[model samples]
Target: MLEHGAAPPSSEPPTAPDPVPSPGFVGRLARRKPVELLVAESGRGEGGAALRRTLTMWQLTTISIGATLGTGIFVVLGEATPLAGPAVAVSFVLAGLTALFSALSYAELAGSIPVSGSSYSYAYATMGELVAWICGWCLVLEYGISVAAVAVGWGEYLDELLHGTFGVTLPGAVSAPLGEGGYVNLPALAVIVLAMVFLMGGAKESARINTAMVAIKIMTLLLFCGIGFFGIQAGNYAPLAPLGAGGVSAAAATLFFSYIGFDAASTAGEEARNPQRDLPRAIMLSLLIVTVLYCVVALVAVGAMPWRDFAGTDAALARIMEDVTGLGLWSVVLAAGAVVAIASVVFAVLYGQTRILFAMSRDGLVPPVFAKVNERTGTPRANTVLVAAFCGLLAATVPLGELANATSIGTLFAFALVNVAVVLLRYTRPGMNRTFRVRFFPLTPLLGFGFCLWMMASLPAVTWAVFSAWMAAGLALYFLYGVRHSRLAVAVAVAGRD
Candidate 1:
């Protein structure tokens, strides 16, 4: 029966390879995946492996706190307070409420969906691929440009810190970008590298660092309040509304930058230990903490000094502390605190960008390579490096103000879209399990959308032009590649035939 040790064959047949599906016209373009599918997709690491869920509520909250509490405070107060006068405190409260509306909507979506990509994923789950693309594109601007902007701000504060403490400074040859009078922004680029290294260690370690930094930021504000309160002249607040209601509105819009990262907590939904319960709680808690801190600081700042005096000054809080106590040392320490706060913002924002890109990559909207997570680090190493490189280049090249306006517009646009997604999802998937439903439903989401739109409309025309160009470019890319190769497009094509 057998010659030369040959054995008898089994009665099994060889398997055929799987076929690649085609893309259908209308259906493929508008394809929407179920939320459950997205939930599963969010957890898959490199090559569809699983990611470690290690972030707790505290970590998530700190992520929001760390990102929201930024150098914007150190800068915006000096600039915005002059416009709103002592009523800048009220402006801070109003601005915070605007973020709160969207924050509530975000809390609901993040809890229910528990995916990355923030509003982009929310739009995909609720709206369609096209809207989701727009949201994702805007997020690329929001997260990417904001990092560069914050880095520039950080660079300035770093200069202030070094000059104040060490009596030394970085030379312009290494500190400024081309158009701004320097070869490159060394400090900004260096900070990006530092953040990249920390993130490479993975999310848990970053959280630990962020928590400590957030604490310092809050404590520094507390110290300012504790000292500045004793100097409150009460008379300083006599003309609280000197700039009138218009001024309050204007200042509120300006102050929105300080409240930018409430939704940052939701971006980490996948890594959150309790996505539903903790994500919502963290979002709300961060908003509450930041709002309280801003209001108290604004009140104390204006009360300690005439609101007019705050205008046109750098390190306003530190200067105020010096004015209150006549101690040059406290001013330096406060300036140093500002440097720390802005660095946390950079870290948190960069963290948010990588996760969003990871989500987009998982959907086949971008290169799948970005979806690859390091098995050892439990992080997306390639994606993190790419983001760092992109941001570092921008930080080293672009000036701060040019980078800042576009971010606010992009952020507000995404917030409005997210608010819309929540409303639409409530109607589309009534039966979907929601761990945290927005309290007032339609009223809240609609108002959130309106508020975001109002602020967006208030931004400069050049900002809109830049954003429009970016979106147009995104549309071109989507049509050229995103449509033909999208996983959902393939699914729709296969399902239609079936």
Candidate 2:
């Protein structure tokens, strides 16, 4: 459940308004307070006390990589290419830039807060309870739906691998759960269940699995790029921006979904070693690596096949390779690799959703049970089970395209909020310490917000309607339950007695 409420009003009304502070001063103020909060929180011995700082920089980098480079690259390119032609490459760069701006803002907050729940926690401590609740609500959509959608895509790729490798085909009903032929997606459900078991084992084990999967996926993509580069044709570059600037921008907006995983790194701040230094490095490094890979993959994919042919195809990459290489054997290998890649993505994302819920529960923003860690496993067992069940249902029932638009829209909203929070925190608290600060202060964060809004506007009208309804439900929950239950509210009451 989500929590919500307005911050309590001051005991006395102000006689005069304070002057608006300069952006730089505001930035410094915002930067310092979160660090103080984190230090205080760390000393207090809360939940996650048993969790060790076991994640190395390499492991952290891979977690970011594994989380970000999943179905979006394999699935979205086919849809985006038709929108922008070869200029889809340009769209990738544009989306990367938008993400980079927001990523910097996140680094600053993660450094200061060093807490979980990513932007949700940052908003609570800096912006006020109401805004924090909204941010957390937006994140629920971003993390939860993304896991479902990606898991469903994973199921499709798994089926592709089976058909390609074994020459044995499962019936449509058995292969696809609630798909066009009305069969339930058993593979997706199975994958989610398996991932849940691993996640319940604790952070160290999960990080190890993520690191290995990231390596495998990265190698597979590099192999594809290496092979496809040979097949590149100059003619593919003709009519580069076939749909013009509008189409390119639309594609860029969609591509923003591919960049969603970088912030997952920030969500692990409490578990990070020297979070103030490592979190920023991890976020920026992961973004840089993925941006380069995305560009290469888009270039190779377009050069190998006609952009028009990719639209609406689920197995777009394998088809392109098959046609280009005329080697069924190589396509089989590629399909198998994609299945592993997408599965890893689903695992990483679902883990992130569970963790975010855990953080909220600890703050009394949601049900307390959500924060309960399994003593033996050191994992948030209750939250993991709940999240996995919901994600599994969606993966089995919903169509991928139906959910993709909503996922992108939700994420853009969260990203925009995070950027704005960075600016707000800067103005609200100035004396705090910060290990990392976003460059150019207000200007960078402002541009990041503007870009996210522009992308949000590009979503279809139906997506907007769905987002509005979800937000309304969240607001209702906040007012009905969360505001009354919040720890911050209780703290205020105690202070009044003193």
Candidate 3:
């Protein structure tokens, strides 16, 4: 509908990019994209490619659940249980509580903003362009690495399921990364490509597929509980607090990764049929469901055997199933469930990562080609392809151990910023139409920020170093390209002249 670079019908006309006339580098970088403009541009959809409204609260909730219930709960128990002993359930609760506070803040913002780009857009509106760029950059790392990591994990589980369920063998020397005893990890690449196919199919279709997969994952866990609960020895719980308060909190910090994906719900803000009401509900519903599932799994895993034996487990749930039921069949089922769950994670997170890039591209903060949506599919196929290809390459090359834990630190920083944006918006634009506001007003956001900071502090110094390097690289890129081409920056420059 646009001819010769005119703005979309409903949005403001972008300033013509003739030259970097008045405002030089520092002036341009200091410029802020007004909150009103962000709100106006968002309703026009990513830049101007209005996303199709397809997801209901149920579909949105499943995306969150499917993303959260991946390899974390399946494999992290071994690492966390040793630190918290039988009190690992308490650790799940603690992590869930921290994530819960952030989810509430996210609910408030998503309902109010109802836009894509997640916290990145929110920060741009409430904070400034620089902060937004950094936050978006952190998200890029968070999601890109996460998708690759999940794909790699999915490959391992797929190998297990194939060999166990059928009489097949995936030669690790051929199917895994060179550092991980394989040449290229074909299954990981395959899954990332399949995710691209699913995502390109459109949001509604992907949501339906994700819903079915999440159900399978949940049912598998339920089967584990139904069988494993019978083998519970209450005696194993007596010395539950053997690791003490410090240890339990430390374990809680580690367990925080398990609850990471509930925010993937917010990524669907623009796609939600009723963003104001549904976004908030989906966030709360998904968090509560995942929390309870995690706690129950922790309790069952600890109750079925000695907590000491949980350390160094490869696939915690599968091993627990075998050890508790003494049945190879149960173990195989759990392994298949893990494979399905991790695949869902890769799908949803990959979907989220692309949408984030699409949002950024619309603002001209990145290559504008990424913002182009496929008119036929009503999806951003180009962005999805770019993200999927890069993630696929990373998955095909990087070993799991080589993938840094910096993703979590990046996530925690973003959550903290989301909470800040919420507080600032509350004071700055108190009358904004927020269908779902956080309860307890300022208290909830403060707690959310505090919780995120505490967990971020718990990460290792090396993780912080890696995170800093990533942020620096992001700033460097922003200065080199983002500042000059940003639609908002051009608009601001024009406004100053006027």
Candidate 4:
């Protein structure tokens, strides 16, 4: 049998024009790019420029934390609290566990494959080109739309901060979209552009700034916990699961969005100083830190404020701070912190999106412009600028209510593919060296895939319909462009001629 990612051995005479039959259409679609080729091609860019590998494990961890820990904690509790009451804390744990299973699979693959494409590359090396393209398409939605979504959320916190600090706020015409009862959302566009500027400076610099912002947000949450702890009433815990197990499950799906950015580290595989070792450690460590912080903050927020009162709350954490302190001082502080927190999410997630496109472009699955690197900064400057423009425009003009759920479903789909790819790689390349392995092998990855499906099922049917339409569009694009331009297909064709 032919080895995965390798061409078939030839048996024809050397004089034959074609030594072997070229891979059939199905075979071309399923062709796995050799891992060695992928690694060898890593960091390569037009004009001999390459991505700089300056990120340490700590920076990688902070990147993931900065990406995953911000927007959800600052805003999602209000949405989930009414669903599960005080048991929202349990909902967070349940969501974290679901993320844990996928994180394990991600860690294993990131350690072994260690490419900038994240799950997309893992799928390419195990599943096939078609699956890889689908995974990559899903990532585009996950990171791109999520960045816009987070940017839109940033505008709300900015309004809160400005209103608290100064005597006034930006007019709704400037702060919100037309669909949301205003003109363009200038604040959202401004925040996306700000994050783009940081990313354009390069990954290491972006990571440094992101780490600082992450520290501030962490301290902010800790401060909230400390102040809010004093107001905890055991009475709030009376009707723990008021809405029952179904509510907990529903809330868990909502909370799952909080876990989305934990895989941001995996997207930095090409930039990591020691990808095989550091990537896995960063992924797992970041998940651990984010989960602990989430569970702790959820408990404190629920204990400090009754779940029934959480229904209409927007910034639940800041409101809780006000209730606990009997002063707007801490509330303003939390709002200010949320602004910084959401900005970090925009920065980190945008960085991941650009890198994913970089990988896809290198493989000829996307336009070459995305793979071009700036010689001075060692960054994909044009790519960053383009992605920023798109996301910023989306944030400025779109009413992203149901669209936000599309981001979650897209992420869940990509994560499920990652879990499946990890298992396939284990079977196809058992001898491949891995710095980290998913414990219990098949069981671990199987559970990861199952959990992804469960959370996806919990989403609204409208989200599924949206996902299906997006996928259909992707398939059409792949057939029209990606399949014809794919480097793997070209390589296979050339090998057959030899």
Q: Candidate 4 — what's its lDDT?
A: 0.88
Candidate no. 2 TM-score: 0.88
- TM-scores for all predictions: 0.93, 0.88, 0.92, 0.94
lDDT of each: 0.85, 0.76, 0.83, 0.88
For candidate 3, the 10 contiguous residues with the lowest summed lDDT are 1-10
lDDT of 3 by residue, 287-393 (tens): 99999998998899899878998888867777777777677887789888998999999998998898788789889999987888777667888889999999999
Worst lDDT window (10 residues) for model 4? 1-10
Q: How many residue-pair clashes does candidate 3 contain?
A: 0
Angstrom error at residue 329, model 1: 1.4
Q: Is candidate 3 or candidate 4 better by TM-score?
A: 4
The sequence of per-residue lDDT tens digits that candidate 2 reaches over residues 234-300 is 8988889999999998898878878888888877765666676777778888999999999999999
**Model 1, CA-based lDDT:** 0.85
Model 4 — TM-score against the truth? Answer: 0.94
Rank the models by lDDT, top first: 4, 1, 3, 2
For candidate 1, give the lDDT of residue 181: 83
Q: What is the lDDT of residue 180 in candidate 4?
A: 81
Candidate 1 TM-score to native: 0.93
Candidate 4: the clashing residue pairs are none
Lowest-lDDT window of 10 residues in candidate 1? 1-10
Q: Per-prediction RMSD in angstroms?
A: 10.3, 7.2, 6.1, 5.0
Candidate that scores best on lDDT: 4
